[model samples]
Target: MAASKIPGWVTAELFEDLLKANVEGFSKVKSFKADSGSAAGENYATIMLRVNIEVELQGKSRGRSSRIKSDFPPLDGKSKPVSYMVKLPHQLEMFQEMMKRTNIFDIERTMYNQVVPEIEAIYEEVGVDITFGARSYDLKNAKTDYVALEDLGVKGFKNANRLEGFDQAHTERVLQKLAQWHAASAVRVTTKGSYTDILLDGLYKEENRPMMTEMMKGIGSNFVKSCPTYEGYEVFIDKVKALQPVLIDKMFDFAKVDPMEFNVLNHGDSWSNNIMFQYDAFGKIKEVYLVDYQLPKYGTVAQDLLYFLISSTKLEDKLSKFDYYIKVYHENLVEHLKILKYSKPIPSLRDIHLALFKYGFFGYTVATGVMAAVLLDPTDTASFENFVGDTEAGLAFQMQLFNSPRFRKHIQVIMPWLLNRGALDM
Candidate 1:
């Protein structure tokens, strides 16, 4: 792509300065390449940039003419293949308006700038090594909003296939990281204080309720329309129609933390897309990182565990391993809380099981709406236009997602599981 197509805030001077700060012994940047970072339909809120740079060392001979260099580690100069993912606000008017209401960028900035650091510091004090996210850098253009992060791809961390979801190995790794992060956040709260100001009720906030309601109505109507095709699911049409008006309010209620419950900072959007896993040479999952903290909230841990289990894990493994997964998470949580010397009463496995049912409707919402999007056929071009635009094509695309075979198969299994567990109760 042309440099002109890149965000105006991303300049050669800015890149040189960023490299100097992040790279060891880095002096000057020669040239760079900028391109779109994310695939289509994966992300909608921000325009992602993948930037690769070739820089000169402190003592590099300033005699290079061509941009391409053959020297690996020459006497004075070394070629550095550095990459970064720069996120900029999407220019769409509707999305821009949504951002204004949601304050997603600001939330993410706080995650990188304050929340994660505070949580990581807790781990540091306890001498526990962990990484929750990519290293972020200070943006050059302080005026416009943007986030620049060290590319995890450079370190061999990649997202699992969203369509396939996570196997047991990958799923366990993500839960382990999440458990530690949650434990640290709990410690942070005990020592520092609650995170009430910024980590508000995430998509279910009162201010965004109207938008969410409208969106849910559209999804519910489409789902009801398609329920007739599924053999035993036709009974759900009226059930869903009855829920169309108050579903958003119900979800908001379910997301609320009960005074007696155990709460932590939830990775509000914990689908497969927001998680990255790194594998060892033997193809075994080694580490995982949770990304995209735009919607993180201070709430019951059930919110995250339910969302991830329902929306991201392999369908077959979901029901069978549900309790086992919860056990895994709670074990790690208890272990870390003890190590970090958390002063609060640690929640037991029974507490987690009870909380999951109490907040079970949140998982229902994920199964019906979010999971459809998650299981959408990648070959089908889904864009933000399909969500907000009033065009016929957009409407058709939206409906098509509900009718997807993969989604249909998942819903048949998950909806019953949720219904049997009283998640469908009003």
Candidate 2:
């Protein structure tokens, strides 16, 4: 796929309008350029802009090249750092159709516009500053659907290496943030009302389940075929095969929110790529931000926790600190819920552990499927298109990726871990 060209609607006027609204004493836009923001086969096309603007102060004007203490500088010859990551529909035909059918853009808009703002406000009322996502900009462009987000990269945030996964520090930081986020959303439900219809179900919505089913079948088939290639994994092959027929159903059950159970708005896609971390000068993570709300769903909090632990943490941390990590998450969650004066009965640590067992299949599926994508060799040819495609090349690519040494090693650990927990049981 080629770099996405700047949309026709992204003109000098748009940049000037944006700068003028945010920058004090804003004047005119000097220049701007758009470049591809993300890799190929990513769901949305992200285009970033290096915009140069002039803002007036005390009847004096300066360009972006001039250093200012604010988020944006005055108009100098040099362009300001890319401020916003612009999201547009995917360039691929198949992805475009799937995105439209799922209304991912619309759901994301609701998340940023309505849900996040409300959640943050709850935190502020309790004097805890929290940000779950990038600040969204309201831009009404009739030519195409787009989302303009405050670029976290400009704030020194970046994704951890997917292959390396998160260590104890990084994983704990993410869990802390997730707990607070979950706390705020839970309180928001009681304070405001239930979440909107758009956030009800994400990946496994009835309409999309057929597609997800096929994807799961592909992974399950390849996994079973490759099991013989690895020595001790033969024990898991039959168990995995038994799961193949019921895998999609179990996934659906885990994703769906049970009315009797505690629930929160889950960051439905919680893999490494969807999370960004900012580091201090010492290379320690200072802040972490969750991104890609295209799959936000209201479900058991266990969904996000299990997915992250299984798919994004290092194997040692995952194997050794699993319960400890869950305890950390619950501690923060209960703390914030009480601080917010949540009315409902607070869920106990036992409650969370029980939920983990109930949702263990969700974690297993992610370990087998999403972990491959996370540990994928960047040099290899892969994308969502070929990942789910039925073509010969697509099938070959899938098998090769599943059989990667990194993935094989990870799975060798994950399968036995899941079996011990009875996660393979249908």
Candidate 3:
């Protein structure tokens, strides 16, 4: 089906069939249900399916229900989804390849297969299934392009506007969660020789440098001009040009570091949108599930921790609680490392905090530039047009973030951090 012709109902059927085929494991097909909610775009529908399966696990049989995502294209001749508003460059494959060279995917799979299981075992020992169900699939037409995951009944996290009062607690929990993942990967790289090779092999190479430079330039130019907050368009353009090589060089340098040597596994993208939270009966925070492995790679553990904090929390509130949250993350890292029986204890908290100066701006820039757009009130979409001439509402919204207090504070923090690390001089 073309990306513009699939309907919600048809998508539901496709998911049901895919789920039944994979979960049944060649047994007779059973019944399932489709949840009512369209996620990301009008063309897609998220569904939940409950199935009866006969399988031997520890000498027992159990029937379980699963959830899966059913993404559909827009109906032919109908209005397209909101995603069509912004035109993406046709060079997506090249970009994906460049991203893969960072070794995030390999790191993610390693963590998913080896590290997370041990953490889940601990959760199970504590009598809580903080993790989601495993994904199962069969070859469909000799291509492994599509696979089915047992749904975890989660739609998405509550809207950002609705997330109030629990910000501090939620931030703390997320930090600890990131620490567990990072510490596990650290142990794996140190103990196993296999992942070390994958990490080294996936390092960014010279061929990707020009493309990386172009991508950053395009994004920065488009973003700066799209909003009205910053004065002197020419000056901003010059700044972007000057910073392009520096940022790209640093990213490549960071990517070249061996995972075993660094003893850290970075969640390349640790923003709030990539994390899913599970709540208790009273709507209290219970656990967090990290998702979207597209940018998992090996880097300083501080990178992920800082990224999550800077992306998820409001910048205005960050400074006040920053020390506490860092402590929580370090404590969790130490605990998980001990449980995994790693020979090396968690790195000194001081060293991690100091290292934040090196790459902290990444979090600030991404959060201010990207998250601000999504977090703004949707009703304010029309006003954004006034910010940037000839730009779409989404891009305009991102540009307007430069004037927000959160964005200002982010710049303030990042400037000093960069200077302290001598990144600014570079």
Candidate 4:
């Protein structure tokens, strides 16, 4: 866990090039400094930077500072925010070892620089002024990948508390934006076919399957273990086990669908923490920006929606407003597509219900596993490597998190409905 003196996931040459090329100023490089990033909410593989520069133009010189985001760092989990399994050093080792062979950094870089611009353009043609992701500059994906991004905090955008998720209004605003994003992607797909293939390249390569499987198993076990009050527990367990072998396929199958099914480029990792919002004069959400694109997947649009709903919305609000939220998303999507002159069948309200029913396991797994990461209290959390190296203690620490009463309520609300609807039937 030795700290490197290197400033960040960046190089000096690219840093200066960025200033000259993207920064709107007559500038000479002065200094670049890496700000200590917060491990509280940031993932491993993220770094923050501030650039000090002298702006000289028209015989005037002034000093200015620019904020930069470094999304790709050394694969070692030490520098990244991987407190999740870092205590169990072997898990971190396993993840780091596997990542070396994958092109995850390249995936994200391509997403921001290439894919999103196209998604936005589709919306623009139809007269809907839309944007995907936050403002960023000097995007690059190389041996050391980094980007100089707009300092969103300075721009008045702030993240929702990871622990306190979206209420109804918050969910509606986000779903509207999500619809705009997905509608654009569908339009792009209708006219263009090549990018989806690049996004799908070896997405579930054999080398990575085992890790995903293990994680799903833990999620399933944790949910069943935590929720002791749910009726028909034995039935749920049997169906979950029956679904296990096929669940991975179903999950990845979301990326490849029948042409008739409505599909889009998924935010892939959409949740509260990755999204930031700005408020209007009345303190209502005016705009939202999706940040991470590291795990972009082309899938059934509901796959992305369900992941965010499961991971970001409070269980009580989601359960009660399920139909209403789905309708809201469908309406926004239909309007955008209509304006774009797309006639292909959009997902109906019925289609949405079916998708949610079919992908119920997807939501459950995310709720029990990834959602725990979303709601984790950074204050009491740790990856003190040595202590977590103890097998029993590390596992207990993970289980203790999702074993709370609230999580149990989430499981109860989620699992029973799926069972009653026969959603888990193979």
Q: Write the per-residue lDDT of candidate 4 for residues 1-426, one digit (tens) a residue.
A: 213633334444545554455433333444434443346334433444443333233122224233432332123222211000101011256445545655565576678778888788777776768777664565343244454455566457877776677898888888988888888777776787646444753356555666666555654555456555554566577776677677766666544555566777777788887788998888888888887776777667766777888778976786688778899999998888777777578777888777776666566557666676666666334343211233565466567656655555566677776677666777
What is the C-alpha lDDT profile of model 3 across 275-344, one tens digit per residue?
6676777878766767544355566665576666655676556666877788888888887777777776
Worst 10 contiguous positions by lDDT, candidate 1: 66-75
- Residue 377: error of model 4 in Å? 1.9
Candidate 1: global Cα-lDDT?
Answer: 0.79
- State each candidate's clash count: 0, 9, 2, 3
Q: Give the per-residue lDDT of model 1 (tens digit) for 272-308.
A: 9889888899988888888888889888998889889
For model 1, which pairs clash? none
Q: How does residue 175 of candidate 2 score in lDDT?
A: 94
Find the 10 residues in a row with the least total lDDT in model 2: 41-50
Top candidate on TM-score is 1
C-alpha lDDT (0 to 100) for residue 22 of candidate 4: 44
Which candidate do you rate higher for TM-score, 1 or 2? 1
TM-score of 2: 0.90
